[model samples]
Target: MTPRADPLTVDVVDLIGTVVVRFHEEYEHAAAEHSLTGAQARLLSLLAVEPLPMRRLAQRLKCEPSNVTGIVDRLESRGLVERRPDPDDRRVKLAAPTAEGARTAERLRASLDFAREPLGQLTVAERTLLKQLLQRMLGITPEPSQNPEQEEKKGGKGEKKREQGE
Candidate 1:
Protein backbone atom coordinates (compact mmCIF):
# COMPACT_ATOMS: atom_id res chain seq x y z
CA MET A 1 0.00 0.00 0.00
CA THR A 2 1.16 3.59 -0.75
CA PRO A 3 1.76 5.97 2.14
CA ARG A 4 -1.04 8.48 2.64
CA ALA A 5 -0.23 12.09 1.80
CA ASP A 6 -0.92 14.84 4.34
CA PRO A 7 -4.05 16.85 3.45
CA LEU A 8 -2.57 20.22 4.58
CA THR A 9 0.52 19.72 2.44
CA VAL A 10 -1.62 18.80 -0.54
CA ASP A 11 -3.82 21.87 -0.05
CA VAL A 12 -0.87 24.25 0.18
CA VAL A 13 0.73 22.80 -2.95
CA ASP A 14 -2.53 23.00 -4.88
CA LEU A 15 -3.08 26.64 -3.90
CA ILE A 16 0.44 27.67 -4.94
CA GLY A 17 0.23 25.71 -8.17
CA THR A 18 -3.12 27.29 -9.07
CA VAL A 19 -1.87 30.82 -8.49
CA VAL A 20 1.31 30.22 -10.55
CA VAL A 21 -0.61 28.74 -13.45
CA ARG A 22 -3.21 31.51 -13.54
CA PHE A 23 -0.59 34.27 -13.38
CA HIS A 24 1.50 32.69 -16.14
CA GLU A 25 -1.53 32.27 -18.40
CA GLU A 26 -2.60 35.90 -17.94
CA TYR A 27 0.94 37.16 -18.58
CA GLU A 28 1.34 34.98 -21.65
CA HIS A 29 -1.92 36.30 -23.13
CA ALA A 30 -0.87 39.89 -22.55
CA ALA A 31 2.53 39.20 -24.12
CA ALA A 32 0.92 37.63 -27.14
CA GLU A 33 -1.27 40.67 -27.69
CA HIS A 34 1.90 42.75 -27.81
CA SER A 35 3.41 40.43 -30.43
CA LEU A 36 5.97 39.13 -27.98
CA THR A 37 6.67 35.69 -26.66
CA GLY A 38 6.62 35.41 -22.86
CA ALA A 39 10.39 34.98 -22.72
CA GLN A 40 10.97 38.01 -24.98
CA ALA A 41 8.65 40.16 -22.91
CA ARG A 42 10.46 39.09 -19.74
CA LEU A 43 13.82 39.90 -21.31
CA LEU A 44 12.60 43.38 -22.30
CA SER A 45 11.27 43.95 -18.79
CA LEU A 46 14.59 42.92 -17.25
CA LEU A 47 16.61 45.15 -19.58
CA ALA A 48 14.37 48.18 -18.96
CA VAL A 49 15.96 48.80 -15.57
CA GLU A 50 19.57 48.74 -16.80
CA PRO A 51 21.87 47.04 -19.22
CA LEU A 52 23.33 43.75 -17.99
CA PRO A 53 25.90 41.29 -19.23
CA MET A 54 24.53 38.13 -20.91
CA ARG A 55 25.90 35.98 -18.07
CA ARG A 56 24.20 38.15 -15.44
CA LEU A 57 20.91 38.02 -17.31
CA ALA A 58 21.14 34.24 -17.53
CA GLN A 59 21.81 33.99 -13.78
CA ARG A 60 18.86 36.23 -12.94
CA LEU A 61 16.53 34.49 -15.39
CA LYS A 62 17.77 31.08 -14.17
CA CYS A 63 18.59 29.93 -17.67
CA GLU A 64 21.62 29.22 -19.83
CA PRO A 65 23.49 32.02 -21.67
CA SER A 66 22.72 30.33 -24.97
CA ASN A 67 18.98 30.65 -24.22
CA VAL A 68 19.40 34.36 -23.46
CA THR A 69 21.35 34.82 -26.69
CA GLY A 70 18.45 33.37 -28.68
CA ILE A 71 15.93 35.63 -26.97
CA VAL A 72 18.19 38.65 -27.42
CA ASP A 73 18.66 37.79 -31.07
CA ARG A 74 14.92 37.96 -31.70
CA LEU A 75 14.53 41.21 -29.73
CA GLU A 76 17.45 42.72 -31.59
CA SER A 77 15.89 41.73 -34.90
CA ARG A 78 12.80 43.73 -33.90
CA GLY A 79 14.98 46.77 -33.04
CA LEU A 80 13.81 46.51 -29.42
CA VAL A 81 17.17 45.78 -27.82
CA GLU A 82 20.85 46.10 -28.69
CA ARG A 83 24.05 44.36 -27.76
CA ARG A 84 26.88 46.63 -26.70
CA PRO A 85 30.33 46.09 -25.31
CA ASP A 86 30.51 46.66 -21.56
CA PRO A 87 32.33 49.91 -20.79
CA ASP A 88 34.49 48.45 -18.05
CA ASP A 89 35.13 45.20 -19.88
CA ARG A 90 35.10 45.34 -23.63
CA ARG A 91 35.20 41.55 -23.86
CA VAL A 92 31.80 41.20 -22.12
CA LYS A 93 28.62 41.98 -24.10
CA LEU A 94 25.78 43.84 -22.41
CA ALA A 95 22.20 43.87 -23.50
CA ALA A 96 20.29 47.14 -23.30
CA PRO A 97 16.75 48.01 -24.25
CA THR A 98 16.20 50.54 -26.99
CA ALA A 99 13.71 53.40 -26.70
CA GLU A 100 11.05 51.26 -28.32
CA GLY A 101 11.74 48.39 -25.94
CA ALA A 102 11.32 50.60 -22.87
CA ARG A 103 7.97 51.86 -24.19
CA THR A 104 6.90 48.30 -24.94
CA ALA A 105 7.81 47.19 -21.44
CA GLU A 106 5.81 50.09 -19.97
CA ARG A 107 2.86 49.17 -22.15
CA LEU A 108 3.10 45.54 -21.11
CA ARG A 109 2.99 46.53 -17.44
CA ALA A 110 -0.02 48.80 -18.04
CA SER A 111 -1.89 46.03 -19.83
CA LEU A 112 -1.20 43.24 -17.37
CA ASP A 113 -3.44 43.93 -14.37
CA PHE A 114 -3.95 40.38 -13.19
CA ALA A 115 -2.61 40.92 -9.68
CA ARG A 116 -3.96 44.45 -9.31
CA GLU A 117 -7.63 43.48 -9.37
CA PRO A 118 -7.33 40.77 -6.75
CA LEU A 119 -4.87 42.66 -4.53
CA GLY A 120 -7.13 45.73 -4.60
CA GLN A 121 -9.71 43.81 -2.60
CA LEU A 122 -7.48 43.94 0.48
CA THR A 123 -7.33 46.91 2.84
CA VAL A 124 -4.19 49.02 3.03
CA ALA A 125 -3.17 47.47 6.34
CA GLU A 126 -3.84 43.99 5.04
CA ARG A 127 -1.78 44.67 1.95
CA THR A 128 1.12 45.93 4.05
CA LEU A 129 0.93 42.84 6.25
CA LEU A 130 0.78 40.62 3.22
CA LYS A 131 3.84 42.29 1.70
CA GLN A 132 5.76 41.83 4.96
CA LEU A 133 4.71 38.20 5.18
CA LEU A 134 5.72 37.52 1.58
CA GLN A 135 9.09 39.16 2.10
CA ARG A 136 9.64 37.08 5.20
CA MET A 137 8.63 33.91 3.38
CA LEU A 138 11.17 34.73 0.63
CA GLY A 139 13.86 35.38 3.29
CA ILE A 140 14.42 38.95 2.05
CA THR A 141 15.64 41.72 4.27
CA PRO A 142 13.97 45.05 3.55
CA GLU A 143 16.62 47.64 2.73
CA PRO A 144 16.52 51.17 4.05
CA SER A 145 15.80 53.74 1.40
CA GLN A 146 18.15 56.57 0.47
CA ASN A 147 15.28 59.07 0.33
CA PRO A 148 15.48 61.63 3.12
CA GLU A 149 11.78 61.38 3.97
CA GLN A 150 11.99 57.61 4.28
CA GLU A 151 15.22 57.84 6.26
CA GLU A 152 13.69 60.27 8.75
CA LYS A 153 10.60 58.12 9.16
CA LYS A 154 12.82 55.09 9.78
CA GLY A 155 14.58 56.78 12.77
CA GLY A 156 17.62 58.10 10.93
CA LYS A 157 17.85 61.14 13.26
CA GLY A 158 19.35 59.28 16.22
CA GLU A 159 21.11 56.60 14.18
CA LYS A 160 24.39 58.49 13.84
CA LYS A 161 24.46 59.58 17.53
CA ARG A 162 23.64 56.06 18.67
CA GLU A 163 26.36 54.63 16.46
CA GLN A 164 28.86 57.05 18.04
CA GLY A 165 27.74 55.95 21.54
CA GLU A 166 26.12 59.26 22.40
Candidate 2:
Protein backbone atom coordinates (compact mmCIF):
# COMPACT_ATOMS: atom_id res chain seq x y z
CA MET A 1 0.00 0.00 0.00
CA THR A 2 1.14 3.57 -0.62
CA PRO A 3 1.95 5.85 2.25
CA ARG A 4 -0.69 8.42 3.26
CA ALA A 5 -0.34 11.91 1.84
CA ASP A 6 -0.22 15.04 3.96
CA PRO A 7 -3.67 16.24 5.08
CA LEU A 8 -3.37 19.58 3.23
CA THR A 9 -2.20 17.87 0.01
CA VAL A 10 -5.07 15.38 0.18
CA ASP A 11 -7.63 18.12 0.74
CA VAL A 12 -6.39 20.20 -2.20
CA VAL A 13 -6.43 17.21 -4.55
CA ASP A 14 -9.91 16.19 -3.41
CA LEU A 15 -11.27 19.69 -3.89
CA ILE A 16 -9.88 19.92 -7.44
CA GLY A 17 -11.32 16.53 -8.35
CA THR A 18 -14.74 17.45 -6.95
CA VAL A 19 -14.80 20.72 -8.92
CA VAL A 20 -13.90 18.92 -12.16
CA VAL A 21 -16.61 16.28 -11.63
CA ARG A 22 -19.23 18.95 -10.96
CA PHE A 23 -18.24 20.90 -14.03
CA HIS A 24 -18.49 17.75 -16.21
CA GLU A 25 -21.95 16.94 -14.84
CA GLU A 26 -23.14 20.46 -15.59
CA TYR A 27 -21.73 20.28 -19.13
CA GLU A 28 -23.46 16.94 -19.74
CA HIS A 29 -26.83 18.35 -18.68
CA ALA A 30 -26.34 21.33 -20.99
CA ALA A 31 -25.48 19.03 -23.89
CA ALA A 32 -28.47 16.76 -23.25
CA GLU A 33 -30.82 19.76 -23.34
CA HIS A 34 -29.77 20.22 -26.98
CA SER A 35 -30.37 16.52 -27.76
CA LEU A 36 -26.63 15.95 -28.20
CA THR A 37 -24.44 13.29 -26.71
CA GLY A 38 -21.34 14.46 -24.88
CA ALA A 39 -19.04 13.38 -27.70
CA GLN A 40 -21.17 15.00 -30.40
CA ALA A 41 -21.45 18.21 -28.41
CA ARG A 42 -17.69 18.25 -27.87
CA LEU A 43 -17.07 17.67 -31.58
CA LEU A 44 -19.35 20.58 -32.45
CA SER A 45 -17.59 22.81 -29.95
CA LEU A 46 -14.19 21.85 -31.39
CA LEU A 47 -15.28 22.61 -34.94
CA ALA A 48 -16.86 25.90 -33.92
CA VAL A 49 -13.54 27.73 -33.86
CA GLU A 50 -12.19 26.25 -37.12
CA PRO A 51 -12.46 23.21 -39.36
CA LEU A 52 -10.20 20.27 -38.48
CA PRO A 53 -9.30 17.08 -40.26
CA MET A 54 -10.32 13.71 -38.80
CA ARG A 55 -6.79 12.92 -37.62
CA ARG A 56 -6.54 16.28 -35.90
CA LEU A 57 -9.90 15.81 -34.25
CA ALA A 58 -8.84 12.42 -32.96
CA GLN A 59 -5.67 13.92 -31.56
CA ARG A 60 -7.55 16.72 -29.85
CA LEU A 61 -10.16 14.39 -28.42
CA LYS A 62 -7.57 11.80 -27.48
CA CYS A 63 -9.41 9.05 -29.28
CA GLU A 64 -8.78 6.71 -32.18
CA PRO A 65 -9.23 7.98 -35.74
CA SER A 66 -11.93 5.33 -36.33
CA ASN A 67 -13.85 6.64 -33.32
CA VAL A 68 -13.70 10.17 -34.69
CA THR A 69 -14.94 8.89 -38.07
CA GLY A 70 -18.02 7.38 -36.40
CA ILE A 71 -18.71 10.57 -34.42
CA VAL A 72 -18.31 12.68 -37.58
CA ASP A 73 -20.61 10.37 -39.47
CA ARG A 74 -23.36 10.82 -36.87
CA LEU A 75 -22.93 14.60 -36.75
CA GLU A 76 -23.03 14.72 -40.55
CA SER A 77 -26.31 12.79 -40.59
CA ARG A 78 -27.77 15.46 -38.30
CA GLY A 79 -26.67 18.21 -40.74
CA LEU A 80 -24.69 19.84 -37.96
CA VAL A 81 -21.33 19.19 -39.62
CA GLU A 82 -20.02 18.41 -43.07
CA ARG A 83 -16.88 16.87 -44.46
CA ARG A 84 -14.98 18.92 -47.00
CA PRO A 85 -11.88 18.11 -49.02
CA ASP A 86 -8.85 19.89 -47.62
CA PRO A 87 -7.55 22.72 -49.79
CA ASP A 88 -3.94 21.69 -49.20
CA ASP A 89 -4.62 18.01 -49.90
CA ARG A 90 -7.61 16.79 -51.84
CA ARG A 91 -7.29 13.33 -50.31
CA VAL A 92 -7.70 14.65 -46.76
CA LYS A 93 -11.13 15.49 -45.37
CA LEU A 94 -11.84 18.33 -42.92
CA ALA A 95 -14.83 18.44 -40.57
CA ALA A 96 -16.50 21.83 -40.38
CA PRO A 97 -19.57 22.94 -38.47
CA THR A 98 -22.54 24.07 -40.50
CA ALA A 99 -24.45 27.30 -39.73
CA GLU A 100 -26.94 25.40 -37.59
CA GLY A 101 -24.13 23.60 -35.79
CA ALA A 102 -22.45 26.87 -34.87
CA ARG A 103 -25.68 28.24 -33.44
CA THR A 104 -26.30 25.05 -31.49
CA ALA A 105 -22.79 25.05 -30.06
CA GLU A 106 -23.16 28.70 -29.06
CA ARG A 107 -26.45 27.95 -27.36
CA LEU A 108 -24.92 25.00 -25.51
CA ARG A 109 -22.11 27.26 -24.27
CA ALA A 110 -24.55 29.93 -23.13
CA SER A 111 -26.55 27.39 -21.14
CA LEU A 112 -23.56 26.13 -19.18
CA ASP A 113 -23.13 28.88 -16.60
CA PHE A 114 -21.91 26.62 -13.80
CA ALA A 115 -18.92 28.80 -13.10
CA ARG A 116 -20.91 32.04 -13.24
CA GLU A 117 -22.89 31.42 -10.06
CA PRO A 118 -19.93 30.51 -7.86
CA LEU A 119 -17.33 32.81 -9.40
CA GLY A 120 -19.75 35.72 -9.06
CA GLN A 121 -19.48 35.36 -5.31
CA LEU A 122 -15.91 36.63 -5.44
CA THR A 123 -14.95 40.30 -5.83
CA VAL A 124 -13.22 41.38 -9.03
CA ALA A 125 -9.86 41.46 -7.29
CA GLU A 126 -10.47 38.05 -5.74
CA ARG A 127 -11.43 36.60 -9.11
CA THR A 128 -8.32 38.03 -10.69
CA LEU A 129 -6.17 36.58 -7.91
CA LEU A 130 -7.88 33.21 -8.27
CA LYS A 131 -7.22 33.17 -12.02
CA GLN A 132 -3.58 34.07 -11.46
CA LEU A 133 -3.21 31.37 -8.83
CA LEU A 134 -4.83 28.76 -11.09
CA GLN A 135 -2.57 29.76 -13.98
CA ARG A 136 0.48 29.51 -11.76
CA MET A 137 -0.64 26.09 -10.55
CA LEU A 138 -0.90 24.94 -14.17
CA GLY A 139 2.72 26.09 -14.70
CA ILE A 140 1.74 28.82 -17.16
CA THR A 141 3.97 31.88 -16.85
CA PRO A 142 1.94 35.06 -17.28
CA GLU A 143 2.98 37.13 -20.28
CA PRO A 144 2.97 40.91 -20.57
CA SER A 145 0.03 42.38 -22.44
CA GLN A 146 0.56 42.78 -26.18
CA ASN A 147 -1.44 44.48 -28.90
CA PRO A 148 -4.11 42.12 -30.27
CA GLU A 149 -3.66 43.41 -33.83
CA GLN A 150 0.10 42.88 -33.65
CA GLU A 151 -0.37 39.40 -32.27
CA GLU A 152 -2.79 38.56 -35.06
CA LYS A 153 -0.38 39.89 -37.70
CA LYS A 154 2.37 37.71 -36.22
CA GLY A 155 0.13 34.59 -36.61
CA GLY A 156 0.56 33.55 -32.96
CA LYS A 157 2.89 30.56 -33.48
CA GLY A 158 2.03 29.35 -30.00
CA GLU A 159 -1.55 28.70 -31.10
CA LYS A 160 -2.17 25.41 -32.88
CA LYS A 161 -2.96 25.72 -36.59
CA ARG A 162 -4.73 22.99 -38.54
CA GLU A 163 -2.27 21.15 -40.73
CA GLN A 164 -3.16 19.03 -43.75
CA GLY A 165 -2.63 15.61 -42.14
CA GLU A 166 -3.04 16.67 -38.51
Q: Highest TM-score, which number?
A: 1
Cα lDDT of candidate 1 equals 0.83
- Report, for every candidate in turn, its global Cα lDDT versus the true structure: 0.83, 0.84
> Residue by residue across 21-79, what tens digits does model 1's lDDT show?
98899899989999999999888999998999999999988999999999999999999
- Model 2 residue 24 CA deviation (Å) reads 1.1
Mark the regions of model 2 whose C-alpha exceeds 4 Å error after superposition.
Answer: 1-4, 139-143, 146-166
Clashes of each: 0, 0
**Which is the leading candidate under lDDT?**
2
At residue 149, give the lDDT of candidate 1: 47
Candidate 1 regions exceeding 4 Å error are 1-9, 144-166
Model 1 earns a TM-score of 0.79
Backbone clash total, candidate 1: 0
